[model samples]
Target chain A: MEPIIKVENFTFYYPDSQVPALAGINLTVQAGEFLGLTGPTGAGKTTLALALNGIIPNFQGGRMGGRVMVAGLDTAKTPCARLAGVIGSVFQDPEAQLVAEVVEDELAFGLENLAVPREEMRQRIGAALEMVGIASLRHRSLRELSGGQKQKVAIAAAVALRPRVLVLDEPTSELDPRGTLEIVALLQRLNRDYGITILLIEQKISVLAPRVPRLVCLNKGRIVADASPRQILAQEKLTTELGLEVPPVTALFRMLRRAGVYHGDLPLEVDEGQRELGRLLGSRASRA
Target chain B: MPGKSFLHKLNPLTKVVWSLAVITLAFVYQEPLPILSLWASVLAVALIGKVLREILPAIRGLIIFAAIFFLFQVFLIDEGQVVFTLVPGTGIGRITDVGLKACTMLALRMLAMTSTIPVLLATTPPKDMIVAFVEKLKVPYVYALMLVTSLRFIPTLQEELSLVIQAQRAWAYDLEGRNIIKRFLALIPLALPLLLMSVQRARTMAISMETRAFGAGPRTSLHTSTFQLLDIGVISSCLLLTAVLAVVSLR
Candidate 1:
């Protein structure tokens, strides 16, 4: 199948800046795939995400090299408005992203801008609210909602566009743990049930490891590691050197392996770690 | 502030037209009684809209302004019989009947013209107002959105201001000191950060709006505003009342 997103030798420099924000990047994302992009601060995660939606060079007015294509449209050439329907982009701040007074209006904003028929816009708004599990908040004011609810409204607003791909740039950074979990779960469902491709960018790997099959690590505007979460997390030295936070469970299993007590793969989640420890102790007891 | 009253149900454009008519009539009437009646009629409409109680504070503020204005105008005019003298034998603050009447008319006209605003605001939600402006008045959607969005951010900006003040206080920056000059200077620190944050927020908001295809093409609104029979009736009545009042006051 043709890739849904392709970035080739892409480099970007903000106007009047000496250093490039993104440098010599090459990546491709297949349709219906769930991928996570992680790196330390200034690792160009947001720059790359913006590039994917054509906001980097087109909207931000920066020097660019190479190309980014989404849904067969070149990012540099296509207008962000046209790309909006193909790739829904959610930003970090929930308060800033919402441009409507009410939850339903926020969802309808994109659809209305795209000039969708009123009836279809209503249906999409209703479906988006239901998909985000905020149907009860349909008529509620955006000011009355909590940060998490506001973020959900933002996501639903993007989701209402019915884009083939969703690219979120540190969406849960300003949210609480429960809010983060809710957003992650909602993304998973959207990717699984609706077959929507998702590219979630974050600073922490723990939240994305168990959920996303593919993980892309960035450092200094370059793709340092692109592999399965297990393959990436197992390289503790590489992750630590790059200033990425390895999952605590993965770190713990790595410690045991170094001490010569365990020889199995690192666990990315707590439950998996618990079962692995149980098996390790059971074997020890049986041997004694 | 959303209500199920008749005024609330009227199309926003109709109410805007009604308010404009009342303001026009307020200016046309020269007699205190006619101007006072115009002001009374605005109050009566507010009462019918069930927003009289909600608009009391705004009306109270307007009353205070009008009272001060009346005092100033009363002292400035020297025609007609003297009602009283503030400083006897010296005409520094003479109170004349003509001055009283003219001031009363002026104050009443000012009150009647300005009071329609709060009533109109109280009855119509900003969203519906924007829809009416775009759908009925042929105003560009982008300009309407800009107006509504700024209104929406007022509370947010206010909250951020308080937060900035608190943050400054945490760092030993006193904004409530007894020294007036020091207090005024303290606002410099407050204003700079708020301005910077607002600029950053505006940039983010622009990007967010663009990402959602805000200016992509000719847009459609989900909420449609049409002139109902009640709107037509109210508009016609407003025009007729203004015409009658204009002729009577002129005569």
Candidate 2:
């Protein structure tokens, strides 16, 4: 399977910043895989996501050193408009992306820009709205929505363009707990059911710990570790030193393993933790 | 329905076309009657659509401005019967017929222009206008997209500014002792916050537009607003009437 995006030594800097935000990073994301990008604040995760979408070289104008290939085209060579078809980016702030009063107009915006025909856009916009589970809000204005609903509408607009991969930069940072779960659940559905590739930058470990198959940890613009989500969670000392949160379930499992109460494969999610406990208690009950 | 207004039924394009015609007439014709009638027609349309309430503020601004102009012309310019003499001719006070004509032109033209705001703005949704601009004139879809986005945010920024002003007022305990300038000075902090927030929003909006597939090239729009038969007929008839009015005024 061909990798959808290949990043080699990507780095970026804002206009007045003394030091580069990111430096010398290499990574590749294959098709149909959920890739988790996690790091402490200022770890260059968001900057890396921006680089993936061609915002860095084209819009920001930093001294870029490496190549980023998305859907077989070099991001450096490709203009923002063309790269947009293959990589859909959702900014952390949904308020920034909403351009129209009505939800239908917002969804149609991306498609209109793509110059998709009117008939097809109607169908695609309808489908995308349904995918994010906000079809009922097709006529609601941006001002009337909660933050989470706004973000979902933003995501629906991104997905409506039919991009091969979706990139979100701390998408749930503005949402409440319930909103966060709703957005995460939608993303999971897109990955699992639609087979669209996903790249998300988040600081919350509970957000990425159980969902993504692969994780890349960054610190001070460098990739310190890249491995399976379970393996990355096991590196508690390193993660804590970097000021990142370890998910509650992952931490619980880590303690249980140390105490010899859990010996089988470590579970990353809450349901798995409950099942493991039930199995252990069941065995004990039988023995007694 | 018997109460349905004509302005509500008029196409947005027709409203714009007629408004432009009357605005153009303001510059050419020296007489006030045409403009007066134009004002009446606009008001009648607003009344029909129940959009009369929407145009009250603009009408208020125009009336105040016209009064100022009439007063200035009557007092300053020396024309017709000298209605009053105050400290005589450093040309301080005089009301001439020519001066009256000038005042009429200024006042009536101001009224003529504002008189149509309800017709163009209140009768149609701003989003549909933008969509029409794209679908009909083939103005690039991006321009229409931008127009709608900015329109969407107008109320948000207005509400934000309102809150800022209220917050500033709450901090001050005194109610009525300050002079007007002092009251105005208090607004500086509020205005600065609005300016700062708007700049931030602009930068973010620019980035957001790009990420959503707004390309530099020509593209079709997803919005679909069609011209009704009434739209076409209304616009054409307005154009013809304007042409006739121009010819008659010239003769």
Candidate 2 per-residue C-alpha lDDT over A1-288 given as tens digits, one digit per residue, 9 for 90 to 100 = 779989888766777787989988899889888888888888898788888888878887767687888999888788888888888888887777788878898888778777788899899989999888899999887788999999999889888888899999899998888888888888999989888899988777786788778888999999998998788777778878777687677788889889887787778788998998899899989999
Pairs clashing in candidate 2?
Answer: B5-B48, B79-B96, B80-B96
Off by over 4 Å in 1: B1-3, B78-91
Q: Is the docking of candidate 2 incorrect, acceptable, medium or high quality?
A: medium
The alpha-carbon lDDT assigned to residue B241 of candidate 1 equals 83
- Candidate 1 lDDT at B63 equals 100
CA error at residue B39 for candidate 1, angstroms: 1.7
DockQ for the candidates, in order: 0.81, 0.58
Model 2, runs deviating above 4 Å: A15-18, A248-288, B1-11, B25-34, B68-74, B82-105, B134-147, B162-188, B191-193, B224-228, B243-251
- Can you give the TM-score per candidate against the true fold? 0.96, 0.85
